[model samples]
Target: MKSTWIALLEAKYKNLKAPNYSFVLDEIGKNPYAKVVEDIRRGFSINEDTDENTDISFGYVLFLAPGRDFLLRISMIAPYAFLAKIKERGSTSQPIVRENTQDAMELDVLKILESHGISMFDEKSLKIGVPDSGKDSKSLYQWMFVDEEIPPWS
Candidate 1:
């Protein structure tokens, strides 16, 4: 069966026109885990605007682990715009401020998910980290949100 989340996301992207951009929805057989991966690779150009290259991708993994534990993992290629904005404030090494910013983003993502009928068993900030991207040692942020219990599917 298709997941409601995947269906919703697919619907959102149904009208996209970017070439080589697609969404991959997968589930672990007999396991309470599912993932939605989006890969976008395209170029943009306008009659009066500068051409631009786009290669952004991201994914969300929803896992219902043993003991009814629920977790959501998000990984993305940090956009240069976002990195620039953060750098304008201060070094990313500032734990407190960086954490707050990450928490805010996480909340926004969660709110969107929740609005679509997903639920959270607890209120807590997402755990975030900036790790080597493994491509060219670039850094990418990973966000992890945890819930004690999974809510009813909507």
Candidate 2:
């Protein structure tokens, strides 16, 4: 699992190409997906929920890269103690805008994630409240990172 996570990030850094990109990883309790939904509804407050209340707690890591014309989003979730997610966006308005390829770049990034042994899920599992598919549904990358063991570097 550690190697897979590491490989995913290394691939993103090497295989992906974008001018505006960001990678983020964090440790979260189970139900992160649900928490995100709650945040969207409750003005995005972190103090409202208890860590112990986390049912499917885990860690998540993400990578986001944006270009002048497109955007990319990638993420990994683990039941252990790590988390990461990535997001990217592109502009389709005009050719004169700088850093406007976020959408295109996002697609490219997603492809990379898929090639790196990442998995995308159609719906949330019975144990976790994550949606199977929809607006906030888990992507293939998120599915790829279902394990929870942290790497040695961490």
Highest-TM-score candidate: 2
Instruction: Compare the candidates by lDDT and give the number of the best one.
Output: 2
**How many clashing pairs per prediction, in order?**
0, 51
lDDT of 2 at 138: 34
What TM-score fits each model? Answer: 0.20, 0.21
Model 2 lDDT tens row, 1-154:
4345434434533322221112222333233354343322332112222222222222222223222222111132332222122223321221111133345433443344344443332222212322344444332233333222221112
Work out candidate 1's RMSD over C-alphas: 17.8
- lDDT tens readout by residue for model 1, 6-67: 23323534422321223222111221222111110111110111111222222222222222
Candidate 1, residue 91: Cα displacement in angstroms equals 22
lDDT of each: 0.24, 0.29
The lowest-lDDT stretch of 10 consecutive residues in candidate 2 is 89-98
